[model samples]
Target: MNLIKVKGKSENSFDYIHEKWIFKEIKESNEQKFKCKSYKSKFKCPAILQKISDEYKGDDSLHNHPHPVIRTRMEPVNKMKVPKTTRKITASKRITIKPTVPEKLKEFKNLVTAYQLIKSTFIAQVEADDGSCASILSTKYCFDLLGKAEEIYLHATYKIQLSDIKISQILIFFVRRNNIGIPCVFVLSDSTIKSLYAKIWENLILRIPSIKENLKRVVTDCYLPLTFAILEALPQTDVKGCWMNYIRMAARQWKSCNLVNMRHEVLKWSFLIPSLPPDQFKNAIMEINETIRDKKETYIEPVTEKFMSFIKRWWEPAATIISFSNSTNDSINISEYFDRHMGSEFGSLTPDIFQFSECIKRICDNSENTWKMMERGAQFELYEKQSFIKINNHISNNLELLSDGKISLEEYFKQAMTSDIHELILKILETRQYKNDVGRLDEFHKN
Candidate 1:
């Protein structure tokens, strides 16, 4: 055994010892003595002999001993192993947790009431602070508050019989799912051109900066100028022509071409083309073309050419016709709703350009806020019911297994431990609470 020399001024100092080895420090007079801390343990520790003195006159290398003396103070002389005991746990009766209906109802009611109170308070604060509490908020202001829109629906309400002059109003509705936010309106004295529409859209984007990246889809009623303008402005955005509008346009074209009997059939064919897969769409188009060719009437040539042109221009390259078709009914509903509200508010008098624009803006703001409130309530109700249903169904299944003697209590508990219903419940609660907080803050700032 070779003796290891460690240089240190104090016993507690660990400068010279290897980190892997364990040792104990002992104070003895002026010099310190180091004993192997692991002398009697499982882990191996380096053996260190007595400390060398500077007064030793012999050769230091010869004085160093190979075999190290075990330090008696560091040895575990009274160590003993204790006996271990095992435990057996018997299965207990299953405890069924009944859903507390009244408590849950109370909780939901409290949450909704709190949400409404916060919303109302915040809106009141905003109105009070502004001092100019007008019925109509600016379209740009509403869009800024609502944040970015995923889809933009454009329509022009033309020939509005106003008090002084007849003007065309271009309405641009920002949409996300079934909810429609504030609509930007442009009153045009003359027919709208691509350049004019492009400029309006450019200005609109400047006001709502997020629209540039968030605007993924643009749906319009097949106006060539607007379609071309949007394409030029938003090159990456997918432009879709409304399916209902396309069919209506096709019907008019067919009637104009004197194909009265075939008009309905042609419209049906056009409607079916958008729903077909790419390969099937091509086959259907070919079949339609063949059917049109069979018509011997001299005027049928123009009708066929027009139908083919529509398919190539709009139907074939469309991202989705279903979304536009779905939104068509919604658009009509919104228009009717707006008309009813406007009628009630203004009665028989036709508003002037400024009044008309403000009326539209006011209606849009009220509708948007109303829709948002309804949507939040509906979402909370839906998530709560879904969570309970899932949890109850799982519990019922586990109870059935337990009653059938197929699973032990331990096994059932193991499975129950795996169920993440608590996480879902907590998440739903947190989400609703967070929505209320953020929504109230947004409303408070009039955003």
Candidate 2:
């Protein structure tokens, strides 16, 4: 009878049971004696081998028992061995506040990363700031308060097409008192496709009694076409560009590969000096450009002068900001910092509604980041009902007159905007028909 050669710890031995009728004692070649006993044999017997990171690597386990049925072993050493379970990383550590996610309900947790919720996105809604007519609670932003409050970002998940009805619902919610009324400049982050997301914008415009033309400003990432779209939709609305955008655009289209050093320098120069004068800012850029052009031995082709010219040529609202803000700097560091912590929705320039909604909630509660996008007159849209438009318009027009179209905290404290914002929010929540994932999660937290 041919004895099978079993691969053991030393590769020089075989544990072969001689041809006994039944229950034969197994013997190995004297030259191939092995020490470790973690291995298993073919007839559902334990083989001698060392256990490794939840895996057994030996000749018998591979040659004798390599079947899916082996995965079903009860003794674990034989029959079948199932792979050990491991914890999966998520965008946020906790998926929901509810005891368990219901079968049919939508969950925002499905849209974001585990690390993202606590670290990247900030969820904000008005906790305070109720002071306006219309019994509306003056607008205040709310979100999670666990992390260090900073440049938290909002990224939408799938496309959240804002129907006019949805817009009216949201607008009615965002502004507390819709009675004082002026066209409000609703802001959104330009990190995603603007037009696709504009479905959210379409809703906001239709919510109010005012014409779309009255919507004054839209700040955005400074995409060329978006500027035209905003102008077309609301001629009075100025399409402001974020400086981060200009830098990103210039680097992509104008900067050559060899200018790695130049690119880094440009990024540094753009944001470090936010308060510089217009002429000084222009000169600073020119210097960077010249440095790139002159460095023949250590660099690639320099960026075109048009890079600087494009920025200098405009006096648009965010021009000054876009001129100095570097999307690659510490400011950008924070944005990216937030991005890194997020498990999903960071790399791409587009986001869905659920992602966007969570981000907006966070931004509203955080003070520094409030309407920071507005500085750029970016292509913006808010999700709300038409009643919201009436309320926001009341705030915007009146606030514009009261404080000259600029937002101020003190103004909000003076009066309530609509009815109680918290109450209205509850009403909106009721209409959501769907529950807020966080709200559901809160239920889980309590349980």
Model 2 scores worst on lDDT over the 10 consecutive residues at 128-137
Candidate 1 stretches greater than 4 Å from native:
1-137, 145-147, 179-189, 260-263, 293-306, 309-314, 317-350, 379-447
- Residue-level lDDT of model 1, residues 1-447, one tens digit each, is 223345333553542232223345545636555555544443233354345663212121221111232322321333223212211111111111211112211122222233332122121101112221111124444455423567666544432445643333334353544433234332332334555556555655665667778888776655666677678878888876443344444444545555555324444455434423343455556666765677646335666667566566545555344333222222221232232234443332465433444455554555355445444542212212323334444555654575577975434444543326434422432332121221111122221
Score every model by TM-score. 0.45, 0.31
lDDT of each: 0.42, 0.31
Model number with the top TM-score: 1
Question: How many clashing residue pairs, candidate 1?
Answer: 2
Instruction: Report lDDT (Cα) of residue 293, candidate 2.
Output: 74
Pairs of residues clashing in candidate 1: 1-66, 145-447
Q: Cα deviation in Å at residue 273, candidate 1?
A: 1.7
Worst 10 residues of 1 by lDDT: 119-128
